[model samples]
Target: MGVEGGLKCVKILLFLFNFIFWLCGLALIIVGILVQVSLHNTFMINDAAASGVPIVIIAVGVVIFFIAFFGCCGAWKENYCMITMFAILLSLIIIVEIGAAIAGYFFRNKLSAIVHDSLTEMITNYKNTTAEFRDSVDNLQKRLKCCGMNSSADWKGFASDGNTVPDSCCLNVSSNCGKGAMTDPTKIHQEGCRNALETLLKNNILWVIVAALVIASLQVMGIVFACMLMRGIRSGYEVM
Candidate 1:
């Protein structure tokens, strides 16, 4: 009787853990969408690697969501096969998640490396792109007080003139102050935008990495409860 009662509690705990996993999946989806919007729409950073971050988050969330639902159903039905499958699937997910987290950790610094390329693409195609995109790049330069991805010289040939930069790169807010003034230290900012953009990416991704590790750690408890319940069911005991 005591063993049955303990198994019942384990079953209940597994159910609750699955529910938590469901909620966590939803949260991750929301976070991923918001980050996606912020990085792509707001910041206009369309870098391949940078844009992929949110996509992977959403994918992981979807996987977790489905697996959580499966686990719930398996627990509710007290099916040993279903429960074992859930455990196996969840173990695979945990491995994938741990790998992702470790990759994120290593890639945190490498993320900044692409900033130069992304910014250069934007600046090079500034006029060819839509007005909104132009405004976004201009806003970034102005807000960061930066001229180009690497240096003010990046704006060479940006205009019909031999050397020029956008007015946003000027220390003083004015029209056409950047024309032929790329090398004028007093006229415009010489620093690159890499530092600013890199900082933003790193800070945001750091939180995501931390949250994933925490959730992964908590999932271990659910796995334990699942295994315990599976044992009770497999022994022909009345786990229900």
Candidate 2:
């Protein structure tokens, strides 16, 4: 194809890619918002340390949203300046994504232990804590269909005479399920919160890795096409 025709094709391709990238950015923003909202509903808004994850997600989403806009405008206007900025931003995002994936992989096993310890600590102080705090753990167990951190046995230390587990941990939800679980193993959920939560984290991390790979692939394409279009524009103009 001629230089002009090639440049046109590159511009079209980059524009389409950027459009999709922009959508992904929007999705990220929505996810981040939802996470924060959920945290608020769970009454964890005051926990500054735990709030960092959602805040970071929101920040990344905003950054990506701008970068995608830059890519689109650069392609449309054939502007080298915007193209360079877009490429630079994309490279930074790719680096961050790769680093996060690597960190997640390396810490995969440790994450479960951390979660286990956290849950255990929460359970230990369940009665002494606020209603919101207790409710959060109950909701988590109910959502995961799990019992204590490791097993129903984990609750033995915390359980007073009749209540071996929380009502949320019961196989069949009921007011007296906690007492039932203490007497009959069948009354309680067999799975533990730690394992269930670990599996969930693993799955989510895998999806993140896959998504990063996909986005990185697209960013690499955008970089290459941007460079190609720059060359074509320069060549065509030089001949004029």
Best by lDDT: 1
Which residue runs of candidate 1 sit more than 4 Å off their true CA positions?
A: 142-146, 150-153, 160-164, 167-191
Stretches of candidate 2 off by over 4 Å are 30-58, 157-159, 238-240
- Model 2 error, position 123 (Å): 1.0
Clash pairs detected, candidate 1: none
lDDT of 1 at 116: 66
Every candidate's lDDT: 0.82, 0.70
TM-score of each: 0.82, 0.84
lDDT of 1 by residue, 129-217 (tens): 89999888888888788888888888886888868888889999698899889999999999988888788777777766775777788
Top model by TM-score, which number?
2
- Tens-digit lDDT track of model 2 for 99-213: 6456546555565555656776777887898888889888878888888777776677655574577788887888967873654667888677777776765565455445555
TM-score of 2: 0.84
lDDT of 2 at 28: 63
Candidate 2 has which clashing residue pairs, if any? none
lDDT of 1: 0.82
